[model samples]
Target: MAINNDVLSIILGGGQGTRLYPLTESRSKPAVPIAGKYRLVDIPISNCINSDIKRMYVLTQFNSASLNRHIKNTYHFSFFSSAFVDVLAAEQTMQSKSWFQGTADAVRQSMHHFLRHDFEYALILSGDQLYQMDYKLMLKEHIKHGAEISIATIPVNAKEATSFGILKADKENIITSFIEKPDAKLLPDWTSEVSEEMKNEGRNYLASMGIYIFNRQLLIDLMSNPDTNDFGKEIIPNAIHDHKTLSYQFEGYWTDIGNIDSFFEANLGLTDSIPKFNLYDREQRIYTRARMLPTSKVSGTTLDKAVIAEGCIIHAAKIETSVIGIRSRIGKETTVINTYMMGCDKYESLDEINKNKTSILMGIGERCFIKNCIIDKNCRIGDDVRINGGKHLEDKETDQYVIKEGIVVIKKNAVIPKGYVI
Candidate 1:
């Protein structure tokens, strides 16, 4: 991978992430734990580091306390290198009194800092996407084609196109038309050319991945319009005709884990025989905080294809196809299947656990049955509790739980009463 020090990278971490509600209730979307180890913000920053782009700015607004801590603890540069990854929280100033309204607006507000450096292009990325790409190639193509704006696009299927910004690029890959979250009826006219193999396999639609390469000046000029706040809805569609906008297609393992079902599947998908996304890649390693903890102690646990992170303790529990996160504690007789337990932040010492002998101790209590569910960090599942996800519930939020994308999402730090069945 070619290094580009002249380009600045920006990771958009400011979204409220309402679609990922309970997970976003306390921390920002990017701060949400993923795959039993890393946070969502690590994805984009890791990609930038592997691509050799050093300078980075993460824009955040909602519940940034934890996000800021994670970034501070994880990314640090030696004095020998100029690489820096800093978080730019939203604040009111003399120039602007309001917070970031959309993605484009967030970048515009933070442009002052990005422009202070002598960088040429700005590589804008999403915080919730899961993938790895050599942005050096994308920037090289942007400069090679003399494009004012180059968008990173991925070929998505029709079912997935409705949630994304679909586009149409002409013969030379210059984008001609774009639609933001087009309805299923409108997808017919927005189709692009596809290969015969893809035609036979059914992956055909070309969707904008919300990743863009912008010539610093063009981006600044485009942001002059106060109405162009959103990149997909207001920015790209208006710039395609006026600017030399090109499409850089990316064929990689990219998935938007912005919703409950997507998040659930993405975490559990890591346990597959052959995971769609590889986290163990040596070259493009996903970086996170270096936690010094003892090895996970597992004794006679009936485990099958589960990913148990460090600092976890599992007694004779039965876990199958689950991703138990760092510092997890599973009691005996608990059967967890197809679940993503984003384990506790810290372990309860034995004395503390003994003190709480009256009620169920922290972590999964004994004899609990959990399936197709997402148990957020610091959750206390009591004994005889059954979270078996049988019915397909959607967008139903309550004090006890929420069911979105047909998956039961127990809110973070929630406590389930003993003998409760759902």
Candidate 2:
């Protein structure tokens, strides 16, 4: 792809991802693995790359080691080309010796580096979303409208509208008002005026995708304000009244993988006949680290509509409607239904496996019945373990696992003892 040097991409990777809990317990939100082999950071970066926007910076703060490593190893640009993907970790400054307070604040803090480059537009994106987008089209709209900032907006339903920052745009697509999770009673007022097609389809509202292309100087001035910490909460809402902010209407498959339940559903959605976010799109493919591993070997495993990644060794496991990650190891007589096993980083060697056979175990145990659960990376499940959703749990945390939105999540590197049923 030819490089577009007019813009500089800034990805918000500094999020602690508290909602994603144990997944974000060890690493930054962006570092969390997705689908099977790809990291969460890969989605936005890939979008930028595919969009021909070459220069990029990933802002990270909490648990940045793994995120930094992944970026360093996965992305490599030619010396001849000016394209680069860099990580900007939060740091203490003389003027303010504090960490990034919010999304806008993170960009505000990293202004020095971004300003150093000669770019007209600053493309800001969220790290934890599943979609494919061409940002160049957005850039064109920003230029055509003669706007100070161009926000990427998506048509959403009323139920999902409650979670997002809703916006009302005029016939010309100029944003008139911005509401951050408005009251249910006031929803009708905030609902967007869409086309007849969209109205008939039940998409009555427009929500922010947290994607924005800002005029360099406008963003600099906004970030300079001490009160403007978050983009959705303060910055965007105020900008609508003052600046010429246009809504670049985006009609595509976009999901904010905010919590465990949404994440689980998104993963399983890929296993369907026609997934919302098609990962198999060759033209607009989701890029990730190329792991050089042997092909997955499955013996006596009945996989019905499942996406089993590379380097997996499955033995007599009946996986139905699931996403088994790379380098995964499923033992014999295991029935995995509606589960997401984010496979291990490396396979346990024969020596390592033999030494840790008794007390320490790795991978799925025999006769394990894992249904509606997410087994994070490097988890150790012992014999006859059951990860069936014990009860209808909502936003509950535990020592071994967490139940978010009624879906159980076995944390990364956690161990489930022999014959444990939970």
Candidate 3:
């Protein structure tokens, strides 16, 4: 495939990720695991890679070590090639001595590094969205419309419109107005002309996907202003009137992984017979770290609608509607349902396993019944544990786990003792 060397990709690693707490407690939003194997950042990076946008930089501020390591280990281009994916964490320099304030600020702070590179357009993407898009197509549209800036817009229903940055575009797909998370009462006026299929589905409002393309010079010029800290809240809304900003309507599957409830649903949704976000598409392959791990070995486990990754040793009695990540260990007589177990970082050796037999061992132990939960990586879930997460349970947090919107999230590297119940 002929790569788009003219466009440089800039993936924004979101601030704090407080809504996705615990998952983002130790790591940044981009580093959060998804689909049992790949990190959240992998989605946009993979999309860019698959779209032939090779020169990229991932800008992050908080908890960036793991994200940095993942990018360093996963994306490796030839030395001869200019294609590269680099992590640009917030640093105190002569110009600035603070962390990234917002999405635009992150890009602004990293402009010095970006200015060194040669590119015609800047492809700004969110690190935590789940979708497969061809940037080449979007780029072609931007050039066709002679747009200085292009924002990817998706048709969203009225119920969802209030939660997103809604916009109105002209007949020629040129954006005229923008609103940041408008009130439900104002939705009727914000509706854009979507496809017949989208309109039939009651998806009339065009919501910004937080995906944008800015002409190189415009991006650099925008960064010069320190007042604008966010793209959705500031930049796009202001730029629509001044610039020839085109609204590139996308009718593909795209979900903003903003909080725990949405994150949980997105992961579990992959267990569907045919997921909205297709991971099986050969053309749009999701790139990730290549681990030399053995194939999963399941014994006596009756699996149904489960997406189990490599290096798993499952002896569970049954696992339904769940995603078991790489290097996971499920002991005998365990029943896992509607859960996402992030799996272990490293395999527990036979000696270590024997030593921890009396104590809590890595992964879900024997006779456990876990449902509607997110078991973070490297957790030690002891024997006879029962965690049934649902609306019946109120939101609360403990040292070991957190229950938000009734979904139990076992913290990463947490140790749940024997006979524990939630």
Candidate 4:
């Protein structure tokens, strides 16, 4: 088997997603549920596997148990010994402090693993995103250009440009200026310095996709520097002035699912009449943990544009534009609309006490109504409850729970008693 030399993949899965609130309060942002079934980590891992990059590592911090389990089960490319996929955690191994302070810090902590590889280049990416591309082609361009660092970039409309890092490049596709999330007024003049020659030569201005490929030695030396602690805030921007930094144009279906609004929007995108993401591609299959279970059976139900996973029993529930997870049972006369429910596995030992404990896991508990709410994994809801998320609107005063864009998040393991309405 001929191996592709000079490239390695590192997925940044650290960072406490405080903005995401209760969803991320327990697990890292990358482990947070998406579309009821998939986690944020699944996006990048699927991309890497489809792109034919065998050896990859997920750098993690914060709450990592769920993230680790998802990686282990979903990414089983290692069933064949020739392939290697791993989840790397922050460790205190004879080299400085343990915790990951920032993105660069996380990579620096895992320097030993990269150091062992014979590959000369490294591809660094974030796990909390949805995109599909042939990274093998990207790597080919990186090596062909002799770039010390090559970044994948996309152009955004000027109005929404402030949300992302803006890039300024010169004529030869050489990146000169890189800024992570600039102000709105700074947008107009953000890339004003670009010469006409650069613009005419198809290399005017671009925004980074937060994807990077770097020479191994250059990355190691840069990461080891005391001052360079963050990739976005520090390292990459500084490298432009000193190193041969280049930009690779990325025209694909890419989305940053970092916050609640974006997360919900991305899931909605998947279920569009003509989806931007093509899941049926046999050539580039997006792999997930396929539990050997029976197909989802809708018991004379009316499902409208809803994604139902394996082992689900929808008993006459009018599911519309929603995403339901595995092993979940929907009771009679239920109307689930614009909602996401991550279900739990069925228990073999079902005692009376266990029945009370695992009510939500088993079924919707008769007449429990949920509208416009995101119910997380393993939650229990009792009978005759009318919970509408319209009550708690987005507020500026308190940080308790803000319902921005009308998406309400119910935390894991929470129980709503019978007839309780929100």
lDDT of 1 by residue, 1-422 (tens): 22577788999995899888889998999999999989999999999999998889999999999999999999998889878999998988777899999999998888788878877788999999899888988988888888999999988878988988888988788899988888998887887776666667566778898899998888888877877789988899989999989999887789988788788888999999889889888988899999998899998789998999999889847899999999888888889998998988887877887787747666788888988889888888888898878455545777868877667788887888999877
Residue lDDT tens for model 3, 224-253:
999999999999888888999999999999
| Per-prediction CA RMSD (Å) | 1.9, 1.8, 1.4, 3.9
Model 4, 1-422: lDDT tens digits are: 21455568899985787777677877988888775566777777778777777778888878889778877777665464545667888888788675888889889889888778878878899988788887888887777778899989876666557777788877677888877888867766666334455456443347788899988889878987865678878888889999998888776678887777777667766666677876666776676666787778888678888888787777845877777877777777777777777776553246754756654444455666777777767666667766566546552212323355667666676666767766
TM-score of each: 0.95, 0.96, 0.98, 0.89
Candidate number with greatest TM-score? 3
| lDDT on C-alpha atoms for all candidate structures | 0.87, 0.88, 0.94, 0.74
Ranking the candidates on TM-score from highest down gives: 3, 2, 1, 4
TM-score of 2: 0.96
Which regions of candidate 3 are displaced past 4 Å? Answer: 1-3, 354-358
Ranking by lDDT: 3, 2, 1, 4
Better of 1 and 3 by TM-score: 3
- How high is the lDDT of residue 151 in model 1? 94
TM-score of 3: 0.98
Per-residue lDDT for 82 in model 1?
73
The list of candidate 2 runs beyond 4 A from truth reads 1-3, 357-360, 390-396
lDDT of 2 by residue, 52-166 (tens): 9889999989999998899889999999998999999999887668899999999988898898898889999998998999998899888988999999999987887888899
